[model samples]
Target: MLKDLAIIDYEFRQILLAVTIDIEHFAKIQLLDKLEQRGEDGYSIVSSFLESNDRCNKDGSVSNYVKTEIDRGKSGCYTNDLVARYPSYDYPVWEFMELIPFGTFNQFVQFVAGKYSDKKLRNSFYRLQSVKSLRNACGHNNCILDDMKSGRPSYQVSYDVKNALRAAGFSETTLKTKMSNERLQQISTALYLHHSSASDGVVAAKGDQLRYIVKRMYRNIEYYEKNDVVKSSFSFFKQVIDAWYFNDD
Candidate 1:
């Protein structure tokens, strides 16, 4: 029973991680919808605005707008400034795209709520925030990834586990099981963080920095479902990607 319970935690951690991405696809479709809604004339406006800067400003600097805003004293866009600051970078570095749609954290939250009427994007944001705090605790808490090998149970996930359960409208004590893939849950949450980050197409498109973080999840599910680890370990993600890829079919 204990093993089964642990496994359930492990499994749902992965599942929660996976389901949370509903917001991502939500964001992407929102983006595309926003773009198409803007249409050619809208794109021309974005383009003309950029014409004032370097020619290939494909990074989307849109200096004309920035300068106009700067003159009015409304200038703080995170993209260019954070790279210069070596310390105390409070502006969610990963959330770099704030210059555009969902222009700020509050706006992003509002976007989620408006775009997704039923899901309580605000609650998810807080849950994600709680998970993020737990992640910080996990990442910075004395048990660095190096120490987890000692196989001791520490406060690695106490708060996060409770908050995540509450987010799911469930009980906080539900996290006591060892069978769960907390890592995957963390991974999924990490992915959400990465997506919600302030950065953009230039960075996120780089590769699996995001995926690698989440991959540690699904350890138990992997063990039971495989002759090898990799396949079962990320099976949840595999199914998701596959379905997404062929979704149009």
Candidate 2:
């Protein structure tokens, strides 16, 4: 599981950094940019990509021009392919929201888009499907992704992350830079621990599983700030996880 996680953490970061730095300017994206810009602690890059338009350039690169010759060989992202697969005609991002698991892909986008998409979020949804899978691998203490896991990521997993990043128009440098941050590593481990604990170490559950993860986030904050729990920050079952703990607020 750890191996799966290593691959996923690197990959998810790839998607986030790609969206924030390289993607074209759009209203939805701007708010997400601000989160990263202001908080200095939030994962807003991923947030922005989730909210904004997902169209690619005719050249299939986010930057108006390709800077490296190697970039010419990149494949079309699953986002475009998903748009191509379902809702056959040209459309926007919201059309396929229902098809996406968990519905948060669309909900999060709508939260930022301020309007629903005219197309579908399936492409983004597929990428997230990869995120959850990778998340499980790491949470279980199994393999490591870039660290060279026992089971290497399938082409599907690799392409999902890569394509999501590409769809957001990010460069390899930007993706790698953000992904290597110690802060993100800490965040990923903590989230993994919390999510895994939520299901009593069962990471196999699907989308409904987010509530446990979200619930744990609030609990972490509460235990840290309110309780002043001066432990090693290592409580696997730190507290009860409840979505209402966050959503009701």
Q: Report the number of the highest-lDDT candidate.
A: 1
Instruction: State how far residue 57 of model 2 sits from its true place (Å).
Output: 11
Give TM-scores for every candidate, taking all chains together and pairing residue i with residue i. Answer: 0.27, 0.22
Candidate 1 TM-score, true structure as reference: 0.27
List model 2 lDDT by residue over 172-208, tens digit each.
6543543343333323333333333234223333223
The positional error of residue 15 in candidate 2, measured at the CA in angstroms, is 20
Backbone clash tally (model 2)? 17
Candidates in order have lDDT scores of 0.38, 0.34
Give a tens-digit lDDT track for model 1, residues 31-76. 4454455352333433333333323357865334433332332335
* Model 1 ranges off by over 4 Å: 1-121, 141-181, 196-198, 202-231, 237-249
